[model samples]
Target: MGTYLITGIGRGIGQELTRILLSRGDRVIGTVRDPGQVPAEWEAFVKNGRLELLKLDVRDEASIADAASRVNEPVDVLINNAGIIGPDRQSTLNMDFEGFLDTLRVNTLGPLRVVQAFLPQLRRSPQAKIVTISSRMGSLSYAKSDRIAYRASKAAVNKVMQGLATDLAVDGIAAIAVHPGWVQTDMGGSGADISVQQSAAGLVKLVDRLTLKETGGFFDWQGDAIPF
Candidate 1:
C-alpha cells in the first residue's frame, strides 16, 4: 500500500478521501487546522495506526515545514486539497480586495508551499504523484465572473502546478490539477451536483492512473482532461 498525504481532512471531500484511502489499506497522513475538532470517525483510524492526523494551516509556511518534518515515510501521493472560498463580497462589482488576496494566498500559494516542504519525501518514492484540487470555475476557456476571487485563485494554481510538473519532470514525479465537481460540502452547499462519495471515489481512480505523460494536465474527477 502507498502512503498518501492529504491536506484539509477535517471535513468535506478531504475527510471522505481520507476514509476511502484507509479503507483500502493505504497509509494516510491527513492534515487538519485543529486536531481537536476532527470527526470521531477519524479517531478510529488513528487508533488503528492507519492514519496520522497533523495540525496544519495551509497558508502558514512554518506549519507546513513542521508537518513535513514529522513524516517519516516516503509519500507516494501528495494531494493539495486544502482551499477556501472567498467571502460573499468578492464580486466583480464590489470586490473585497483583502478577501481576494487571502483567497489567493490559501488556494494558490498554499499548495506550492506544501509541495516544496514535502519534496524530499515525495522524491524518495518510486512512483510519486502530486494532485492539486482545482475547480472548473477556474477555466479561462469557460470564464464566469460570479466568484471572481475563487476563480482567479484556482486558475493561478493550475498554472503553478503545471510549472511544478515541468520542473520535476527529471525526477519522474507526476503533477496535475483535478476539479472535484460540485459536491455537497460546506463550500459547494446543499444543492451541489454530486455527493462527496462520488467525487472522492472518482478522484481516487484518476490518481491511480496518473503517469508522466499526463503530468501538467488539468482534469476532472472522472479523469477527463480539462482545458486550462
Candidate 2:
C-alpha cells in the first residue's frame, strides 16, 4: 500500500516490478519513454487507479522535474531503474567516446537528477527510501575488461548513491544500490541465468527490508551485501 515511483517501465525488470507491485495492491507511478509502448497488462492497472504511467527519460532533468511535479502524493519509495548497455564498440583500445559519455549520463547522473527533483515528495513520506539499480560489472573488485563504459558508469553511480546516503542520513531517508542479477531480459539477453520474476520478487523483498542502517550499502537482489 505504499506509493512507489519507478523509472523505465517499457520492458524488462521495470515492467515485471510494476506488475508485482500492482498485484500486491501498492500504488505505482511508473515512467516510460512512450506511454503508447506500455504493455496491455500494465494499462489495465492504470485504469483501476493503481498505476500512473508518465513519460520520462531519466537522462533529461527537465522531464524528470516535470514528472515529479505532476505527482501530488508523497513517494514512499523511488527506484532508479532506467539504464542502457552502452555502445557495442565501447572498449579500452577503441572506445566510442560520445557513447561512453551518454552511458554515464543515463546510468550515473540520471538517478541523482531524479532524486534531487523528487526530494520534496520523498521528504513528505515517513519511510522514504531510494533504490538505484546498479550492476555487479560496476564493482571495482571485478576486474573485467569487457564493456568498460557500462562498468564505469555503474561504478560512478554506486559512489554517487553512497554520497547521497551520507547527506540524507539526518533526514531519515535510506538510499542503497542493488544488483538485479543477470535476468533474462532484453538487456540481460536469453542466456542470462535468472528470470524477470525471480529478480523482481527478490528485489521487492530487499526493498521491503531496507533500513537506515543499510543505506549506502551495495547488495544483490537476494539482499546479500556486495563488496564495493
Candidate 3:
C-alpha cells in the first residue's frame, strides 16, 4: 500500500480522509495543529499503527519541517487538506484584506511550504503525487459570485499546483488540485448537500485512479476535470 501525508487531520474532511486511507491499508501520516486536539477515534488510529499523528500547524514553517522529518518512509502522496475560511462570506467590495491574507497563508502558501520541505522524500518514492484539496469556488471560470477570501486562496492554490506539476514531472511526481465538494463539515456547514463519508470516499477513489497525465488539472470528487 502507499504512504500518504495529510494536513489538518484533527477533524472534518481531513479526519475522514485519514480514516478512509487507513481502512484501505495505506499508511498515513496525519498532521494536527496539536496532538492533544485529535479525537478519541483518531487516537485509536494512531495507537493501532495505521496512522501517525504529527504536531503541525501549516501556518508555522518549523512545525511543517518537524512533521516532514518524522516520516521514515518515502511518501507516495501528499494531501494539502489544511485550509481555513475567512470571517464570513462577502462581496469583494466588503471583504477584509487582512482576513483574505490569513486565508492565503494557510490555504495557499502552506501547501507550497509542505511540498518544498518534503520534496526529497517524495522523490524517493517511485510514484509520488501531490493533491491539493482545493474548491470549486476557486474556478474563476465557474465562479459567478464572490466568496472573496476562500475563492481567491483556492484559485491561487490551483495555479500553484499547476506550476508544481510542471517542475515535479521530471521526477515522476504528479500534482493536481481537487475539489472535495460541499460536504457537511465545519467549513462546509450543516446545510451542505454531501456527507463527509461520501466526499471522502469519492476523493479516495479519485486519488487511487490519478495518473501522471492528470497532473495539473483541477478535478472534482467524481474524477472529472474542471477547467481553470
Q: Give Cα-based local distance difference scores for all models.
A: 0.95, 0.94, 0.88
The TM-score values for the models, in the order shown, are 0.98, 0.98, 0.95
In model 2, the runs with Cα more than 4 Å from the true position are none
Q: Positional deviation of 161 in candidate 2, in angstroms? A: 0.6
Q: Please list the Cα RMSD from the true structure of every candidate, rounded to 1 decimal place.
A: 0.9, 0.8, 1.4
Error of 3 at 208 (Å): 0.3
lDDT of 2 by residue, 41-142 (tens): 676778888999989998888898899889888999999999999998999999999999999999999999999999999999998999999999999999
Better of 2 and 3 by TM-score: 2
Runs in model 3 deviating more than 4 A are none
Candidate 1 residues 1-228, lDDT tens each? 899999999889998999899999999999999998677877788998899999999989999999999998899999999999997898899999999999999999999999999999999999899999999999999757999999999999999999999999999999999999999999999999999999999999999989999999999999999899
Q: Give me the displacement of residue 153 in model 2, in angstroms.
A: 0.3
Model 3 per-residue lDDT tens digits across residues 1-228: 889899998889888888888887988988888788777766566777878888888889998898888777798999999999875745677877778888899999999999999998899899999999999998988756567788888899999999999998999999999999999999889999899999999999999989899988999988999877
In candidate 1, stretches whose alpha carbon ends up further than 4 angstroms from where it belongs are: none
CA error at residue 93 for candidate 3, angstroms: 1.3
- What TM-score should be assigned to candidate 2? 0.98
- State residue 202's C-alpha deviation in candidate 1, in Å: 0.1
How many times do residue backbones clash in model 2? Answer: 0
Clashing residue pairs in candidate 1, if any? none
Least well predicted 10-residue stretch by lDDT in candidate 2 = 37-46
Comparison by TM-score, 1 against 3, better one: 1
